[model samples]
Target: MMGKNRKQFYFGGSYVPLGLDKHVPMSEWEGGMCEMRRLGINAFRAFVSWNRIERIEGKCDFTELDYAMELAEKYVLHVVLNVGGMFNNIQGFRPPPWLSYACHCRHRIDDPLKAHIHEGADLMLCADDPVLQEKAYAFIEKAVLRYRGSPALEGWSIWNEPHGDPCYCECTLKAFRAWLQAKYGTLDALNERWGTVFPIDFPSWDDVCPSVDMSPYAHADPCMKLDFLNFLEDSFIEKFNRISALVRRFDPDHTTTFNLQGIHGHDMDRFQVTNPGISAYIEELAVNPRRVNLWLNMYLRSARTGRDGQDKIRILETDSGPRPTGKRPGCQKLASVRDWTFVAHGADMILSWIHRTRITGGHALQASMTRWDGSTPPRLETAGARGQTILRHQERLLGASPFSGRCGVLHDMKMYRYATVERWHGSFNFTTNSHDGAFMLMQDAGYAPEFMNDSMVLDGRFRRFPALILPFMPYMTRSLASALRDYVWNGGILIAEALFGVKDENMEQFWRKTPGCGLDEVFGFRCADMMYFDPVKDKILLGAGEIIPAEYFRECIEPSEGAAVLGRFPDGSPAVVSHCWGKGRTLFLAALATSRYDYENTALRTLIASFLENSGVLPLFKIRSEQNAGALGVYLATKDGKTADIAYLINYAEEPISFALFPDAGILPEKASFTDILTGKQYDDFAEITLEDRQCAVLFADRKDTAPV
Candidate 1:
């Protein structure tokens, strides 16, 4: 294994296939590689279409891909070969005419192209279909097996964004039945859980497929519907694992990844999981100037980091520049700063989408590094500049990781997705919002959190944290509840927010009062009253503070002998409650509220800060500015170079400001001296630096050398 301090980072663009060319031309691809090396880019990626490489079932060719690889070698550029054709038409997969005519593939009723052939709108081979998988694997094996010896293969994008999973084909039906049979073991258990019965259980399971429209099943048992969705999600994961295993058998030196919409497909948004075997992530939820899309999208792809604990994420494809308003000028600064944010956050790579702009495809907004005539654009220059920075600081930046923040906001796909479908659709909602809202508050408080998704919790990775902020997790399982309890009992702080442990994995309301599933034992509180508080109608006054904003759900806690009321509502009911559990205490905020990172509300901000301070979970690094004067998005990155621990600061405000750096004592120097890298301008006289509007700066602090620079 490589030393801990050593790492490799990819910086480049997707070399778009030469469109409108026959016999697989190499001129444009070769030119793209030359351009990449000239820009100081060490690597570039290209999407190799399975359908195009093997247009005929048996007769296959790697003309375009082989040439592309050869050019990459000639130009000394590392190649991230994205295999598996995605998209529907001319730009991506060209489903063999034989398969198209022979009806070998399948599509869901909702497939846009199902109504009329539009050529690659969102077409994909049915992985569940035996005949298609058999032929598809043949194409995959042949296309990739030869590349096993290719020197430029840094990574393999097995597939990009398969999130829109569809197709209720015959084979999928059989797979779903097998999955259910294995899960339930018998029809009795299945019927009991799903509230359904069939005389011929095996055949009945085999006969069912994805529901085109779930409306007709309005009165049907929801668990049954959710089961199918779960089955479909499992099938996709299985397929990813199968293909990934195939590639690793021949090419073991590269990282493998799947595109986002978690695991792939928008339909599975309510529930998604990763293939633990997949080595990397080429994510979605990306746009040009990735910051504009960073946080929320990070929420969607954060689970990727849970794989191997090394958050090696890359942008496989996305709008090369801002997709808004044609091609605006001076957008490069934002783009570069955005790229820096990704690096500071521990992402190993970023490919800013296409190297050559699109002309023939349906992707009009898909701008690339260069214009159609191959002229360098501002976007490419910015990307090149970002790449240069990564190349220079590759060792320190990649070697160090994000600081383990004092407090965290937890997230779970299983709970959030299930709750969304059940509470809003099945009418059993416990909280108005997901934990993303609480994350905004965490950010506003100038804290970066470790995202603890369900996988992380299940893998026993959440125990190390000193404190965790769980926001509105209603669909927690018995095991997860015990995990949380164990953390709290083992002297770990837990601040659970709203509807704390009230529902089960199935979103089934636990008959017991609030804090269900033995969580009552953990929290030491029982629900006295439960109802939604209408902001306009009812009031929840927090002590002498203003009325708490109306929230979707509120649980009035009746504290037990050991628990105590920290805050109360206007009606004299407890709004915030705390109780000692073993070595630590759990604080429960009874109402849901969100603080905007930039436009933070006074009441909400004050409330959250007090909670953190009281729990001894204050922010690790404090920006000694005029009490939130500027809209600066502060992100701190550790530096273990010869000296100097670093924190990256991005001024999101329209104007510049000089903010002092005073990290928590042990995390930084007691004297706190620094210098900005962008300008070798030393800050020996003081511990602060100025940044322009929408600009980025890196602070280098040496603990051993505390004297001002």
Candidate 2:
């Protein structure tokens, strides 16, 4: 059973038992368990599909799951069972036929050219259907009660990527109406907020319906569409609450959490749990493995501020190797950095996709730790070596938490949804482009910033950061603007990029000035006009005589009193401006500079570096490395009441690089001694250390306290 002080870091891969779609025998299942023990894997995910467990309505089968739990107990391994209605669509085992076509109720939204039904396949049940919810809850209750006391059961994954975006059937329409009623309170209020008129006005609540057309030119009103999207997400959260409450009624001693697909579709503040899980596949979250740190820190910050205020997270699914027929090589190299990245960020558990490859069908030649015949490959060997290394120092490592920066980057969910509604480069591309670029730029300068989401802003968490960056944020809530003003008034540095606060909380353009909600006075600027241009032809000139290429979006600005112009466009328009407001300072870039700071952009990096230094927010200790030493990562941690602080270094470069650390006085004791945790090498003073490609190093240094000297 897990308690408040429980601190066991789990690491393992998933496995499919016998009699599933893959048709593995019981012998192979037992062998897989043995392999887990040999590889130092202490926990795994056990899948319980609704279709498989309940072949006939009102009758359930627990034979296979029972044996799997017994095997886990015998092997001294922990199990995180995957049950309930909301599981992965592909491996979640499609719903049973009785729950599928018998009720004639499933997602009816589909392409005009394609059929909705397939042979031997079933769609997910409509979540708004009362009958469906009753049966799903019944199944969940029985499953939790059966294994609540099992020695090996650790937790439950109640929802897998809970996104109901595709369901637009009659049942969903009914739910959407009810949601609107609760929000607007009356049809007249709804009509006023939605701005509905004669031909399109919602005369009655019954006339309101969500749009099924998702094309670029769909005629759905942005206001109505936004509410529909909110309703979908809220419906999922409601289902999660009901199911979680039911589970807790029977099993209150173990952890309960749900998995989300990356960080796009849901609100971070809505759901709070001790352990929050995410599906962190590189293909889904990052363009390449080297950029995975951006998502890692974003989710880690969310988990750190969870219900129990613990810094524990679960990577419910990550890539173990490359896909079949893919051109990417060095699977072992990528896998090592991926798993270690989780550890560097203070993650509690790491669970990859699968343990062994399948022998047949479309999933043939899929990536797995072991071959179909149960032989360990080079990748598996690398995993085993890393596992042994982590197990050796679990006590000290688990006791420490990753250090967070005094800086913050804003991630506004309202702006993210507005982008989707406006059809401006889509949601993920628009938000992550700016958020990831700002995050990477900070890390490149050896300052890793935490992410402050919309929830954080509303809850007064934004005031904790000494410096904050708003990257390409265009939408603003009145509450958020008020918080930013208060934060700046109390002496916090604020930096915002292009299109900051052009739209209100409801995606309405501001009538007075661009930075709405009194932010014009706070930032000392008003956007007169804006333009989009071809970045290849335009350029920006900094006050220091540095030439930087322009990006796609730029804003024309008029500076207010006490504001100074720092940069100019080709036409001599104000490109960047700075102001003194209250006791703090504010900087505004007329262009999206942060979105364009790639690995090769030196000019932008220099400009951003100057901004940090001028604001007195740069890291005290600088990590210097040779050129082409691709994206080195540095993370620090300290045990409670201990004099030794730990630092973790990760090198993503292809060639060997020499690293040196220089400390600023009063921040790090100049006479402190260094000890390598992995190698046990002691250095009398800070010295140069060599790290090969994709290497991770842990160093311990004695300190007077966890504060500046």
Candidate 3:
């Protein structure tokens, strides 16, 4: 129901009424609910850990949950009930002591009580265990049947930050074998693909044991490692789907969602790949504003879609206040910036980690909406103010959507899998850094492009974009290669960096020409040889004898007769080439130029601007500022009919600065006026707007022919 129109916004905090015995206390629930209502907060995410309600098997005392639902109904607040196997409380994944003991025994491990749970906090019951999963299902069914009719119950959150780490239990091993058998059909096929030999040979399906050794020196078979990761991901997806289907079976009217951890160990293309509702936490996970922007962009792309369809995107748990661990403390200004950033990025909902202070847990001293005595803090006030502003502008906000032009950056999980196996430590950043860099480069050039995954491409979503960029993608599949070739031939501009498809999807080197999989002809070049380059020392020779810095890796490219050399290495070997393929064009960089950009470098941004210009991809608008242009982030949300748009200009710098928004040639040609949403003041011209340090301004722009303000 929430995704029906994709226009609603929900804002609140996470409230944990952990039974009647713990957290915020039974006495403070009514006050907390009253405060939430008074602040104009519409919804909150409440949790019910398995350990808290049913410590003893078959006996669930739902008094705390029932009271929470009643209070929510009384306060006229909606609730997104988080019911799952793992509870991310201070105790951390405490799955009923009895269940933990039983699972340890079944898995032939030492007693869970004797184990140091903190060191291995993720070690819990094998999710593949049938009996254990049945118990979980029964518990969920009971909860759903009790609250499905309640008005306060808006939906259900089934999984919280799902992980794909293998349990290595007997049940999990059996499930893994089944998964492999279904994939390969025979041990010979599996062994051949994985190159299994004397030491780690899988004579039988049962002989396969997933190796979780990610140490720096561990020499695990790359193919086996990739498959193991895939198997675990598949298993996680299966469990989540089963639970989601179970919830819908009983409560068909309500929606089901999951909170995604950042895209480090997990892959968004695998989980909630194309789902309509997606939630994620970003408080402690993202270190800086730039990374926060990156995380939001990635999640927004994964959650929401292009013009064809849309999804409900929620920042489920952002920081509410300062943490006891002073490393990443939260303040009123920081909280405000983060909340507005989410709103600007098109988040449908924004919830803090908590509403009230905890009585016990590792985060006992962490910041909350209310203090121990149910008093509001500065951050709470900030939330209330932001909520009020959002409520006031709900109509315009709902009618508008972020405008991302026809350009997409590819986010392939196979490349992630390959990097994880080959370069374990910083492998996760290998693909992501380039992605973030490319995204920022586009942003700096006044272009808003969405991120597309392999599944989206295979399903024909890639055809929606006029240009596609592949940043450090090395793994290639036959089908994907074919699709990409067709895309380029049909007039799609493709920009790629070094090591493009040098390896197959299985992480094996390609036998054909260097670009591999018929791509050498598509790009009119092949990688002759490659070597590591120094970021500070190596230089690439550009047009008119201009030189720019190169980094990390370099490829000596051999170009076809029809290809034009764009740049050359120090020794005059072609480093960047541009070629015409069919009706489209392909630009290939034989170096890691995209990944080498930082705040100090203008090379990547300049290169991106040139490519976009040459390919005729016009940016939405241009920013004119005397200050640091990178410090100001510009976002535009266009009304459905394209008669008006809303712009959010955020100044991430410390000092005040003035800037102007000049619409691109054909975009917003006859715009009439700009009105600040917060101040309710209208300006007829878009010449100047000055913002203080870390401040943001929201302006509504109406065209000349639209309704008058």
Candidate 4:
């Protein structure tokens, strides 16, 4: 029931109840609801803070709850109730003080008095505590019982971004020590891994204290730090699971999920598994740096990450209010980019962070759709238009899988997270901070970027993605290395970048007598000389014979028996090379030289575009006319052999361009004559059409006997 197929459409709405004031009635709620409904918003992820519901322990209030549910049902809008409060116990919802006392345990590692010194918030209850679990279950059971039969309820969000630093309270320390002892048998083994020198008599695990002090060589092992991070992630997952089980008992059909703070230090892979149907909150700046496009590429990739392909992807909250810091980019551009991108990426629902300006409360700056003057902003209009477009085309876009073929980019979550830690060492900057650049390049070139998990690789799914791109992943497990070697032997395209295969599971440099695939042979290169360039001088040097530029730090290596150089370093060493392994191809970009914008250049774009074209991974789209060159947006949707719809083109820029499309050309549209769905502009002639930038054109085509365009 949680994974049922729901018709896909851009469900758009704004965040309501921007503040916490009981006296402020729902005076403007009706108008805001009417406006969103008119604009085609079918779903709303409204917040139902825990602190607000049970202000005092056992003193529950359902007045606001009943009002919200009634409003949702009256408007025919589904709701995703955000139970956890938003901020760091500042506003929105939070656990009441009395409830906290009831659930509090000695296992919490964070000190209540010092908690506000860091993020300025009281310590949250430890999930491992039995008392905390009982209270959490009680709260969820009560809430679910009230809304179980309500037609307005769409889903329940367990907690808001809970991925932060570990709680260092005494309670957590004791639990952690117990956990370590069970795994290693003794504290001496833990000390060995933690690099702690055992004195004449080392203290027992029970006497050990969890301290942030990483002084003394003994207590500061990198492996220990890594393990601690993993343990914290596991603890968070346990909390989420406890809450999910409680909610499911009363509301079996409702979905449950948690939002991850994008690019934050949380272990996403673990969080994704804790609750299989999780949806990520797509922050404005997190995915879309330019603030123009909706980050369509990342959303589609994330949607597919749902377990067993049964989860619905939705934008928990988008930026519909003022730009943070009143930046140069206007809110309209941000809204348009987000709106159109959501439609393109197949997001079923969209919710913004604000619906009305908060007059006298927390975070007043982050307003909703209506301003302080009770007037609608330009962004509201854009959201409405985009919502209408999605509603009109929902049937074709939803419930369809976009990826085909076998090639995929292996996404090792551990490797990706570890890459972040490695950045502090200052040796590599190989797409280290972000995977968006590498992912976008592959997608824009028409290749489906499959996120192959590490476990999936061990299960042989790694071989299914005929092509695998390891974008500067420095560490690899022994198991992963063996899988890669086997995949290569069986003919799989392996694309690797700089500083890869250098570290083992312990984060130690591999020092074997014979060179392992770790780094010495995987890319036919080894680290010889590495340099960091000043940001101003960080330019990729393009060789005379090369199409793309060479990176700043170049690794010098000799080609293997079957490998040949495709591009070279300044010193004539191989930079980009191709090696034939079994029946597949191995492309090695030996340096970390290019920026994300480099992939947008015409040359690299054309090269990658051409590669995908030849690889037979391009999507088949029907068109009314043919086009070449210029910025193009193409979308294709297909159902069981009965019917298919193709969204031809849209220009997101501000210039008009023309290209030719020949009916007999190899890339012709599948339909003869098609009707334009956007402007309703019909075309039956086979001729080139000039399109103005920032304008979208959609043509609906059928396989019936129609004249060729």
Q: What is candidate 3's lDDT per residue for 1-709, written digit by digit as tens?
A: 4323345577898785642225876777888889889888888888766677787887888888889889998998888877653432211255566655654433322232333343243335556767767777788788888888888887777776666555666787788889989998988888777764235557777788776564665666687888877887777777777777777888888766766765544545454322333454445543455555556566666555432323445677667766767455675655665667677766667878777767776566676777767788776877888898887787777667677555787866666667877773384365767877766667677777777778878889778778888988777889999999999998889999886888887777875678889999999898857898777778887876666555677987889989999888888888889999998999888887767665446665666678777887777777777766666677777766343377787765556769888766455637567778766777786687888876777878866678744
lDDT per residue for candidate 4 within 1-709, as digits (tens), equals 2223366453654345322533235776666667667767777766665566676778888777678778878887777776542433211344455545554443333554565453324545544555555665677677778877787777777665555346776556666777677767877777776663223234776665443544343344566666666666556566665566666666778677655544323334454322322233334343334223224454455545523333345566556666455332334543554455555444566666556656555546554566665566676777677678767776755644333423465555566446544444345445533355555555545454655566767777456565766765657678888888777776666777665666777787655511245434544544544454333544333344434543444444557766667666545566666666555556666665333433335455454444444544342321332333324444443343223344445554445656443321333345445566666776654366666755655555544475522
Full candidate order by TM-score, most accurate first: 3, 2, 1, 4
TM-scores for the candidates: 0.86, 0.91, 0.91, 0.82
What is candidate 4's local distance difference test score? 0.54
* Model 4 TM: 0.82
- When summed lDDT is taken over every stretch of 10 residues in candidate 3, the lowest stretch is 105-114
The TM-score of predicted model 1 comes to 0.86
Clash pairs of candidate 2?
Answer: none
Cα shift from native, residue 667, model 3 (Å): 3.3
608-686 in candidate 1: lDDT tens per residue?
6676677677676556665344356566665542223666777654467677765556565455555666666555433
Cα deviation of 170 in candidate 1 (Å)? Answer: 1.8
| Evaluation by lDDT, superior candidate among 1 and 2 | 2
Among all candidates shown, the one with the greatest lDDT: 3
Off by over 4 Å in 3: 1-8, 18-21, 87-92, 100-123, 196-201, 212-218, 269-292, 305-309, 424-428, 641-644, 669-671, 703-709
Please report the TM-score between candidate 3 and the true structure.
Answer: 0.91
Against the true structure, candidate 3 has what lDDT? 0.71
lDDT of each: 0.59, 0.70, 0.71, 0.54
User: Which wins on TM-score, candidate 1 or candidate 4?
Assistant: 1
Order the candidate numbers by lDDT, best to worst.
3, 2, 1, 4
